[model samples]
Target: MISIPDEIGNLSGLITVELHLNDIEGSIPTRMKELMNLQQLDLRGNRLDCSISDEFCQLKNLGWLALSNNKIHGLVPTCLGNLTSLRYLDLGSNNLTSRLPSALWSLKDILELDLSSNALIGSIPPQIQNLRAITKLNPSRNKIAGNIPDRIGSLLSLQFLDLSLNFITGMIPKSMETLIDLRYLNVSHNKLRGEIPDGGLSKNLTGQSFMMNDALCGRNPSLQIQPCVNQISQQRSNLVEMHIAYTPRLNIMIDVTSGLEYLHEGYSSPIVHCDLKPSNVLLDEDMVAHVSDFGISKLLDSGQSKTKTKTLATIGYIAPEYDQKELCLQKEMFIALGLR
Candidate 1:
């Protein structure tokens, strides 16, 4: 602060400073730049404003910076790229805008970057791909738009990514599959379309990633988008087409016998696949998929059958009453939710 810069900067051996939760006023001190040994600084929740001094970037030893919830505005000083040892950066809830300094990616050791709730706009820079150590990134609630660079997946260490509440559009880059370490991802409420990687983060994420977009679908369980979601979403032909119609069709081999008429012949049941399982279904001589084992099938089942013919799936796939199957001895106890 301008009031105590002489006292605060006098401690040449000091490694950290916590001036948050105070009524500090005036521009940050030019003398505070004298803390050459400082490794951490937290000036959050202050009334600080004005473009940060270019000299602030002189603190090359600084490893962490948290100046969030301030009144700072104007482009983030490109000099920040000089903080090569930084591991954390949070500039959230500020008025900052303009093309983010490409130097930002210079912090190779950075683990978490939070620039959400700012006025930042423009395409997410391709230079961001250089940050290979990022573990969590929150760029939500901004004006960012344009195609998310295909290189975004290069952050193999990313554990959580939140790009929601923005104007971003275009198909999600397939390179995103490179993030095998991702546990939680939210690209919802954006314009990202296309299926996520089958072997990478896409496998661990869920339908939550592709929701709200007119044309986005993926293998992520949280984004349970149907084939139609991709059929209509043809933004980038360069990436692999992601549509439901291309669902894998398994090839089957079977043999037919005489005296056994076609089971579907004039059948009033219409033979909808309420429960499709290997035990309840089989392939005919014509190699056509069929449902046969109906030991625990439901009559009211039409669409996605919650209670299947058998206890074939795991917890998430089981019907609520299916757990009560322990009390009922019959093949069918309660009806599953579906069409009749």
Candidate 2:
């Protein structure tokens, strides 16, 4: 049908409506609320336009709804959360805007949720942990910011998660290490930082799953980021216990200086290693020290001598000028060596 007839609403006993992959070009009828027994509705891959009507929430028996790939705009009706029987929902590839309604997280029985490729803003709320039965969650390609809630690990049944192409910041929550059922994850193209957890699902993730996130470091070589700085400190302890002879102090000093020199002059733009400390200097089997941990490093523009940053380096090793919000590579080595 070219368009759903408003008279179809007269079928009050209808339990399901599937009009996907059609040329349907009109708005969802408000009279749809008359179908009290409707348990499922699928209208994806259509040319339908206009905002989702709040009347749909009147269908208390709605267990599944799919409206992706439409011209749907405006806020998702907050009352949809009243449908406790909703087990699946897809509103992706639309023009929906505004913050995600907090009420959506109340869907405790939701099995899959797809809200990707929209203009939605705001952070994922902590109440998200209520979706304990969720198996797949996709909110990628939106403007959502803030941390991935630490409680996300509580989704014991979660096997697929995608939060890519957003403005999300902060470390991937350590609690995610507990997601034993997770088989796929993607947090790429975001502003995430710190160490990526090294257990469970994370162990199986590849670099492709985290590409374009410059500050994320992990022990997984496939992730292609730097090794976590804490791992270097752990290695140092192991070496000391094994009675391995420490590299000469002079050699370490030279190696560190050489590394800094390269950072300052070896590239098109100068890089300032914000955190320099003994623990951040990693030693290979050959006792060769390699400078690591660029999680908070900054790259200055050509001819720029200093820049401002909110991320603080190691407290004791931070240069005095850093406190003023000015950042440069100057004197950090001395501070790292406790000479200041």
Candidate 3:
């Protein structure tokens, strides 16, 4: 491994330096700051094992900076925010050990920011809404704590968001439902609670998105959490009191069967709903029954027929073969019949 030579900085007219995915090691040469005309600097996927020097911040024209997947340590230089022209910044998969600098959020022109897989602390500040042009924001797998700012919905241009494997708390704001451009979201393994916002990006999500968060509840059965029982009961009571026509039993039956069919044969890999009972079936406003609670579900791989599990499904609903701790395609079919 070799370090960047100080003489390399003599190229003051240089506009780009893309020495990434190499064996480059040692601290970044401060002399590189003399490259005042530099617009992009990417040294990611290297052995650069030192703290970021503040001298690098002197490049006022820098627009794209990627230093991810390295051995870089120390606090992110707050002075880097002075580069108002920055359009992209990626510092993920490093040893950075400081709270996110508030100044970083001031990069209003930044389109993508990734600070994942570090030891960073501190809450996501409300000023994050300032990144109005941002399309991707990932800060997962960190020690970051505090509530997700409601103002996050203000980033209408956002398309992907990942906040998983963190110490965050509080409810996911309903405001997120308004982000029409959002296509992917992951907040799993956090302390999030309350009803998950419905519609929009949520409609395309699955159980994997909200996995391991025990407190969340919503009408999306694929979330695999318990339904909001009190809310459902109230809705039903109101319909009866208002003399509204309830959904026909035949319709409910059809909805349940359809849900089962999708889980069994719709995908390359079949998903087995281990528990198929009345409690796990939720009725929507239209009285449509959706299969919920996939906490004990199983997904079989290609060409795989049977699998075993130590976990048991509900007593009355468990297939006879499942009593021997084995699960096969017939297991779900048997339970579905029992539900009928």
* lDDT (10s digit) by residue, model 2, range 58-118: 9999999999999999999999899999999999999999798898999999999999999
Per-candidate TM equals 0.63, 0.70, 0.69
Rank list by TM-score = 2, 3, 1
The residue pairs found clashing in candidate 2 are: none
List the global CA lDDT of all models: 0.67, 0.87, 0.85
Top lDDT prediction, candidate number: 2
Q: How should the candidates be ordered by lDDT, best one leading?
A: 2, 3, 1
Candidate 2 residues lying further than 4 Å off, grouped into runs, are 232-340
Report the C-alpha lDDT of model 1 over 105-197, residue by residue, as the tens digit.
Answer: 777779999988888887787878888899998888888889888888788898989998898898778787777788888887887766555
lDDT of 3 by residue, 109-195 (tens): 899999999999999999999999999999999998999999998999999999999999999988898889988899999999888
Regions more than 4 Å wrong, model 1? 1-7, 219-222, 229-340
Candidate 1 has which clashing residue pairs, if any? Answer: 206-222, 206-223, 207-221, 207-222, 207-223, 208-222, 227-244, 280-293
Clashing pairs counted in every model: 8, 0, 0
lDDT of candidate 3?
A: 0.85
- Model 2 CA lDDT for position 207: 88
RMSD of each: 17.3, 17.8, 21.5
